[model samples]
Target: MRPKITLALNSLLVLAFFLLLWQVLTVLLHVPAYILPGPIAVAAVVGSRFSSLAASFWITTQAAAIGLAASILVGIAISLIFAQWRWLRRLLYPYTILLQTVPIVAIAPLILMWMGSGIGSVAFIAFIVCLAPIIANTTQGLISVEENLVHLFHMHNATPAQVLFKLRLPHAMPSLFVGIRISSGIAVIGAIVGELFAGSSRVGQGGLGYSITYANAQLETNYLFALVLAATVLGFLFFFLGIFLEWYFLHQWHESRRAESGN
Candidate 1:
């Protein structure tokens, strides 16, 4: 059997077991739907409200995608700059790390104040949360070039740009992809946080965060569970998107993928 196929089947079996447990627990405990809906009930709600839920989910996903894309561009650019000069990295990297210490919720309101209440502000919030990992990972990747390689480049009288594009960038891609994966996952969390602070929808237009909030306010546990599941699926899609990218970029030559592929 193909490894990917085997892995998928195993994942499904585990998911089925947990879902069975969830159903049994709810029935055994006689939990009220409003308080603790079973997976079955959540599935039913998902089926019944598929349209509205899907619409809201798309909104949140768009914000996450936007933020993650921005983080990738800015992260790579800044990482290159850091690699080019040690002084800049020393002066600016601390502030970059500072972003991780503060909670997204704490700064979300300030973003709302600056960017206003809209998708742009929400994307900015996600951008902030997703920025640190990429910068940190990519910077290390660039700086960790082999000493012999640096000498080789210098001996060839290569320009800094030539060295970076030809040697450093290629070397750093694995780490860059790792950062991409991490940023992709956290981007969703950032979007959810942004929506928690500033999410509002007019009629049919809403995001998952807004739906979750509305469900809780109205004591709709099944509906909340359904939206949460949709958000989970959305995040999973983004994560696997990163995985596919990693595989595409690195599978050609990276030893890890080569070994995995048994090539």
Candidate 2:
């Protein structure tokens, strides 16, 4: 089948399956809107609160963007440091894994309490959540460089900086994208967690977390669903943006992209 047709069919299948399950639950379980609002109700709420939702979304997106950028810069720097020092890598690797496994939810409130809430807290949380994936992936990419290639560079009297820039960095592009994709999802979770703990009462900040809190307090299930759907869409957008960037950069020469092209 043509790619477009295959994609369309898959999308339709997914939508149909979800709709079917939602309708069944709504009808058979007699689930109240308070407990689980139907998709239609959620969509309606989304439409009605588009303006307010859009503002909240913008705030969250800004926070995520700042944090992800910081992650990329810091992760790359840390990776390069480790790549240059094998012993340092060995010493730090276990601690890196420990950081990734630590629960962000548990730490978020502490972050807020320390930072005194607002954008600083949210951005810090997002950075903490997103940084690990990039650091790990970048380190893998740097170390994965071929021994023969390194020897060739050395024989050519290449400086360490030259070798890193001309060889390892280029080779690491695929792994970099992998880290970026993982960081995208983590950034969204970080932002939401941050909002849960550090949301502002002032206008023009905070996001789905605050919306959900307000709607729940007011017993507006539909509105709560709307906020949640907004968050889900934001997460999906981050994931798909990473995918598109990966394809755009790697499609010319990468093995995965080449396979797709051949098909």
Candidate 3:
């Protein structure tokens, strides 16, 4: 069997073993469904509440996707500016770091206040949470180009724009992708956090965070577990999307792709 297939099989086996153990322990110990719903119970909730869950999933996905896309575009632009100006980078980069250090929960309300309670606010929160990594990694990549190659470009009378576009950007692709992968997971968290405060009030109109809050309030442990699973799946989707993009862009010449293939 191929390595990818084998790895997937291993993962499924582990998941099966875990679920089996969970079911057995719950049954043997007489654990109440409220305290810990077994995987079977969670699956039942998933089946019964499929439409509701799917609607919420789509809401969260929209927020996360918009935020991630904004972060990529704006972050890359900021990184390019930083790459061109050392003094400006010194002045502004610390503030970006400070932005990252501040808790998103603390600022989420302010975001809702400024942007209003909607998908836009949620996406902004996601953008705020995930923007720093893109700026950091992409800035490093843009600046870390080989000095020899830079000199070669200069010798050919390459303009600053030419050097930036032709040499620096290409060299930065791997690092940019790394930032994107890291930020993808964070974007989901931000969107969910945003939804907690800014989600719609109407039934079945909110995102996973709203569903989670509703479940907790109702003390519906089984439904809550299912919602949690849905959130996890959403995060995984973003992460795998990042991985696919990295492979698609870098597979041609990057050493990482070669290493993965060999392994």
Number of the predicted model whose lDDT against the real structure is largest? 3
Give candidate 2 misplaced runs (Cα > 4 Å).
1-7, 20-30, 201-205, 260-263
lDDT of each: 0.89, 0.86, 0.93
Per-residue lDDT tens digits for candidate 1, residues 33-75, read 9989999899899899989998888899999999999999999
- Model 2 Cα lDDT, one tens digit per residue, 37-118: 8888788888888899898888888788788889989999999888888999999977888668989889888888888878
Candidate 3 error regions (>4 Å): 1-7, 201-204
Estimate the TM-score for candidate 3: 0.95
TM-score of 1: 0.93
Clashes of each: 0, 0, 0
User: Could you report the Cα RMSD, in angstroms, for every candidate shown?
Assistant: 2.1, 2.2, 1.5
Q: Write the per-residue lDDT of candidate 3 for residues 127-205, one digit (tens) a residue.
A: 9999999999999999999899999999999999999999999999999999999999999999999998867647657
- Residue 252 C-alpha lDDT in model 1: 77
* Model 1: lDDT of residue 30: 98
Q: Which pairs clash in the backbone of model 2?
A: none
Candidate 1, superposed: residue stretches over 4 Å from native: 2-11, 201-204, 260-263
lDDT-best of 1 and 3: 3
TM of each candidate vs. truth? 0.93, 0.91, 0.95
